[model samples]
Target: MSYQLTHPSLQHDRRILLSITKWLLIVGVSQAVQIRLSASERKRLRKIARGHRSPVREKLRAQIVGDAARGLPNTVIAHRCGVVEDTVRKWRGRFAADRLEGLKDLPRSGRPPSFTPVQVVEVKALACQIPADADVPLARWSCPELARHVVAAGVVESISTSTLRRWLTADAIKPWQYRSWIFPRDPDFAAKAGRVLDLYAGIWEGESLGVDEYVISSDEKTSIQARCRCHPSLPPGTARMMRINHDYERGGVLAYLAAYDIEGARVFGRCEPSTGIEPFMALVEQVMTQEPYVSAKRVFWVVDNGSSHRGKKAIERLTKRFSNAVMVHTPVHASWLNQIEIYFSVVQRKVVTPNDFTDLAEVEDRLLTFENRYNATARPFRWKFTRNDLDDLLTRIDRHQAAEPALTEAA
Candidate 1:
C-alpha cells in the first residue's frame, strides 16, 4: 500500500492538481491573446456597449472589444459578460483583425436562384394581367397555376409555387386577389366630374354660389325587399350574438327615391312600387315645392344616367318643370361622386339590412321615420375632394394608360 500510494486523500489531491494545471493552461492561452483599439474605435465600442437600443449581438461584441481594450483577460471578460471564454476570444480576434466590420456575419453560401431576372419579370407581368388577356380559362392566377404556366411557356424549366409566392410576397405582388375598376370611358369625364366637385365646394363656374342656392344629390335605391323571418329575431344577450333568421318569407320589393340637400343637411324620400319618370318627378316635387327651395334663387340637382333621368331630354324636363331647378348629370358609372349615395348606404345599414319587416309598408315606415331622425342630427358631409384632386387622379390614369402599351409589348 505504501509503495502504491493508495490513500484516498492523496488520490483526491492528485485530481485537484490536474484541474489546476488545466485551468492554468487555458488562462495562459487567453492572456497571450491581446486586443487594442484606436481612440475612435474605443469611443464607438463604449457607446455601443452602453446603448439601450443596440442589437444584443452587437452590444455583446462591443462589450468584448471594450473589455479587451482595457486589457482585461478573455476569461474575466467572458465571466463578466456571462458568455463562454471562446466567444470572447473569437470577437476579440475579429475586432483586432477587421475592426467593426468583422463583428458582422460574413456572406453565406447557398444554391443560386432558380429563376433569372427576366423570368421573375415575366411572372410578375403575367400576374398583373387578366387571365382572359393571357388566353387562360381561369379568371385569376393561383400561385400553383402561375408556376405551371411559366414552365409551360418556357420562361423557366421548373419552379416551386412556394418559391414564387415568397418572391411575390417580397415585392408585394399578389395575382390571386382583384379589385373591380373601370376606366373613365366618358371622354367628357374630366369636365363633368369637375363641375360636380366644384358644386360641392360651393362654387359654380368660378363664382361662389349664393346663399339662396341649394345643391341636392338624388338617387333611387331599387328592389329593397321586405323579408319576414320564419322566426323572430333573437335579441343579443350576455356573451351571445344577436341571432337573425337566414331563411325568410318574401314580403315584396319596393324602390326608395331620395333627395339629399348637400348644404342644408335635409333629406326628402318616398317609397314607390317602381322607379320611372313619374315617381322620380314626385320626389322632385316633394323637394322643390318646399318653402326655401320653392323660392330659392337656384336649386342644383345632381343625378346619374338612369332611365328615369337620362341625357339632355331629362335635363330640359327638370329645368322646365321648375324654372329655379338645374339638373346636373354625373358621368355614367360614376354614382360614387354623389353625396346622396352615402345617405342611402347609411339607410341600408341602419334600416333595411336585417330585412325583418312583415310587409313593404313597414319597410316604408321605417325608412321614412329614420330619414326624419337622421335629418334632425345630420350635418353636411365634409366633402373635401376638389377639382384639383380630380385632375391629379386623371393625370395618374393617363400615365398608367400611356405605360400600358409598353408593358403589353414587353409581356
Candidate 2:
C-alpha cells in the first residue's frame, strides 16, 4: 500500500514563522498583494481559519488569504497571522496562482532510495534462500553478511548493511530467525485424534458417556536417568536459587509408566525396569483389578503407537483380559494428545529436574511416593482443545502444505 508522508514541521510552523518575523521585517520589502475569492470559498476559508482542530499551517494560510482578500497589505496580514511578511506574500501569490489547492503542501521528493528497484527486490528474495545455496558458508543471514553476498552475486555494486536492514525491515523479512515444523505422517491422523479429543470432552463416538465410564490416558516416560550430583544440592535461600553441580555420577535409569484417568483425575502408575507388553499388561491389571474399574460400565484406554499396546492385537488383548476395557491408540507421533504426558511433564519439572537421586531404588521411591502425593490433590487436566480447534489446525496445515512447492520453487 502507498501512503503520502506529511511534513511534521508544518504543524508547528507558526512558531517558527513567528520566531523569524523580526529578521524578515528588517529585510522585508513591500509588494502589492491582493486575492479575490468566491463567497463560498471565502466562507470555507473562514471556517478552516476559526476551526480549533485545523492544521496550524493551514489555519495560518487561511487567515492570511482571508486578510489579503479584505484588501489588507502584506505587512498587516503578516503581523496579524504572526508570520513573516514573505510568508503572507507567498500564500497570497499561491492562492492567486492555484486557489485552495495552492494552500496544500506540494508533494515532496524524499531522500532517493540507495539501491535500484531490482537490486532491492533481489536482496529481499535472497533473504528467503538458504545461505549455503549460494555457496556462502553460513547457516543463516545477518544484515552485513547478506549485504556482502548481494554485492558478490553482482546484484548490486556496493550496499551498506544498514541500508539492507532498512529494506528488509520495510518488508518484514528476517532471515536470522527460523522454526522447525513437520507434516503429519499418519494417514488416519484426524479421525484418530478426533476420537481421543471426543473422549476428553465426555463424548465417546457421538454419545455422552455414562458416569460409570472412564477415559484413561496412558504413556511410558522411558530412561529417567538418576544422575547423582558430585556435590550435594543446596536448598534455595533468600535471593538465591537451589544449585546443582554439573558434574555427576551416573546412578542408573528407569522407566515410569502411568495411566491418568481423564475425568476422575486419578493417576495409576508404577516404576518398571523397562517398557514392554508384559509390563504394560501388568499396569492394566493393577488399574482394572480395583473397585470402580472392575465394576464400571466401560473403561477406555488411550495409548500411543508403542509396541506394548499397538494394532488390533493390543485392542483384542485388552478386551479379552478385561471385558470393560477398550484400547484407543493415538495417531503415530501424536503422544502429545495423551493427558498422561501432562502428569509426566509435572514429574519431570518437580521431581526429576535436579536429578540428584542416590540410586535406582531412590528414583523408584520418589516416583511412587510422588504419585500418591499427587493423586491426593490432583484434578483432571482442563483440556480445551476440541474438534473445532483440530479442524482449524488441519486447515492451516493443508494451506501450508499446498503452498510448500510454490515456496520451494521461489527459493
Candidate 3:
C-alpha cells in the first residue's frame, strides 16, 4: 500500500466535513437563542428595520435586521449600531424566529386627543362664523372672540386664547389679517372678477405691464425742526444748529406722492407740493403717455379703492382710451396688497425719517430724489392672487347674501 501513506482524497473529504460542521455549528448555535417579544415590541422592531441602510451605525443595524441571512456578533453589532447589546441580542433572536417582520416600530405613547376629528371640525366652523348677523362693524375675527365663541359651542371643555393660537398656528389659519376684497353683489361680479384675473394672470402666463397710481404718497408728518439743534451756532464761516418749533399744531411736514414705473424695471417717486386728485390724474396720464412702444402687451394697474380712481367720467375716459389697460382696486380696508405700500414704507424709513424738515419743499425734494433712485431699476409687480381666491370669496359672499332673508315688507 505504498508504505501505508494516508489517502489524499480521504484527507480532503475530512477537511470539507470539518468546514461544513463548523458553519452548521455556528448557525445551529446562533439560532438557539430565544427572545419572546410582545406585539408592541414586534411592531417597534419592524419600524426600526425599514428603509435603506445609512453609513451611520443605527442604519447598519437596520440593514442587518432587514435581512434575515446576515448575522453579526451581538456585542460588535450593538456597538456599531448604536444600540445596547441586550437590544441587539433580543432583536437578533426575535428576527431569527419571525424573519424580517420582527423589526417593526411600536406605536408611540401619548394622551388621546381631547376632541374627536369631527368635533374639531365643528369647532372650527363655529369659530369662523361672523360675530354679527351681518359681516359689518366687526369685519374680521379676533382670537379672543373666536375662542369665546368656540367655547360657547360646547365642543370642547373650554378653549383658551392660547389654545386657539396654537390651533391657528398648527392648522395654518390666519383670520386676523384683512384680505383684499368685497363680495360685489352686482350680478356681473363673476364677469368682472374674471376680467380682473385675466389681466394679472397674463403678467406671468404671457406678458404684463406695470400699473399703479401716484397720489401725493403725501402725508402730514409733524415735529419737523425749524432749526438744527445738533450743530453749533456760528457765523457764515461757522456751523449753526437750526431751531425748529416743537409745536405740531402750528406747522407740520406735508409730503407728496409722485410715483413712476420705468419699463417694468424702475419705480420712481416724487414728493409733490400737493396730493390733490388733479396731480394724481396728471401723473397717471403722464405714465400712460410716456411708456415706450416697448413690446408691452398690456398695462395692469394696482390702485387702492380711492374715490378719485372711481370717478366715473375719469375712469371711463382712461378705460376707453386704453383698450388693454386694466385697473385693479385693492379692497377697502385692505391696503397691504398694494406693493406701493411696501415701497412707501421703505421711503419713510430710509429717506424721510429720523429728521425734521424745514419746509414741505424739502420733504418733496427728498421724496423725488428717492423716486429717481428707485425708478432707475423699476420692475412690474407680480401679483399672485388667482381665480381660485376670487371664486372662494364670491362663494362666501353669495352664501352670506343668500342666507339673509329679503327685507320684510314694511307694514
TM per candidate:
0.71, 0.66, 0.49
The stretch of ten residues in a row with the least summed lDDT in candidate 3 is 213-222
lDDT of 2 at 341: 92
Q: How are the candidates ranked when ordered by lDDT, highest leading?
A: 1, 2, 3
State residue 39's C-alpha deviation in candidate 2, in Å.
Answer: 38
lDDT on C-alpha atoms for all candidate structures: 0.90, 0.90, 0.55
The reply for model 1, stretches above 4 Å from the true place, is 1-72, 77-86, 89-114, 132-135, 152-154, 183-188, 235-243, 311-313, 392-411
Residue 14 displacement in candidate 2 (angstroms):
36
Off by over 4 Å in 2: 1-121, 154-174, 234-242, 395-411
**What TM-score does candidate 1 reach?**
0.71
Q: Which digits, one per residue and each the tens of the lDDT, describe model 1 over residues 47-117?
A: 88889998999999998888887878877899999999889989988877898998888898878876689
User: Taking the tens digit of each residue's C-alpha lDDT, what string does model 3 give over 211-253?
Assistant: 4321112112223332322443333434655444343322344
